[model samples]
Target: MVVKNLIQHLAQLAALEISDSEVPKYQAQLTDIFEHMDQIKQLDLAAIAETFRTTEEENVLRDDIVTPSLSQAEALQNASLTHDGFFVVPSVMKDKDAT
Candidate 1:
């Protein structure tokens, strides 16, 4: 059974401020939850089998194949700004203390 004092203590532990009017509402909810848990505890499931997954679906992945890709020069050719051999982008960091 969920009592008013226990609910107040739980709220204090969780750093929550529950008003007097809300105490009865929370007390009823917590009691209902505990009653449902008690009903679950009385269930007989000794014949039930333990399984990890509910579905039989398997992952389908493709083979990792090395393919020819664009070169550095080709990649940087369309860039609006470029340094010696790399693309130059605007700085995004604002903190001076960032290393």
Candidate 2:
């Protein structure tokens, strides 16, 4: 039995804000989902064979062949910024010392 309080608690844990009017709506939906899961648990399927795939088609893969490609200079030709043979981008991480 999914209750309104439980739904509100779940929303809090997930960092979601729900209105007072939405609590009962979520509670009913969650209760129905749980009931369906419970019904699935009651089914007996011990004789059924476990299957990893439903389709008969097998994965077709191309042969791995090494090919000659671009040089270091060619690869970094279009970069907006380059430093010591490496592409220099803006810093993404914040400095820990600068609080």
Candidate 3:
């Protein structure tokens, strides 16, 4: 794609309002990025393994232990409206024709 169209597309994707004067700067930067990607694409790496990550890091998750929680009375203490043991909430969505 042409630099001008690419810049406009990038600006739209990024939700940016670019001035006419800034177009050249963005175009130059995008052109450089595309050039680098093209250079990488031209590389011969048939012997290399596909690497998802370069570091040996793992996510540490805590044990799912049961614990004491707030009672029904405590939970509904700050509620404006409550029926039985549940909090009452107003309807958030309305019919389109109601407008």
Give each model a TM-score. 0.53, 0.58, 0.55
TM-score pick, better of 1 and 3: 3
Best by TM-score: 2
User: Could you give the candidate ranking by lDDT, starting with the highest?
Assistant: 2, 1, 3
Compose the digit string of candidate 2's lDDT tens values, residues 22-63.
988898899999999999999999999989889777776787
lDDT of 3: 0.83
Q: What does the lDDT read for residue 8 in candidate 1?
A: 96
Candidate 3 residue pairs that clash: none
How far does residue 22 in candidate 1 sit from its true spot (Å)? 0.9
State each model's CA lDDT, in order. Answer: 0.88, 0.89, 0.83
Tell me each candidate's RMSD, in Å, in order: 9.2, 5.5, 6.8
What TM-score, to 2 decimals, does candidate 3 have? 0.55
Question: Which regions of candidate 2 deviate over 4 angstroms?
Answer: 61-99
Question: Per-residue CA lDDT of candidate 1, range 9-99, in tens?
Answer: 9998876889989999999999999999999999998999888877876665678998999999999999999999898999875554577
Instruction: Quote the lDDT for 90 in model 1.
Output: 93
Candidate 2 clashes between residue pairs 3 or more apart in a chain or in different chains? none
Model 3 segments more than 4 A misplaced: 55-59, 64-99
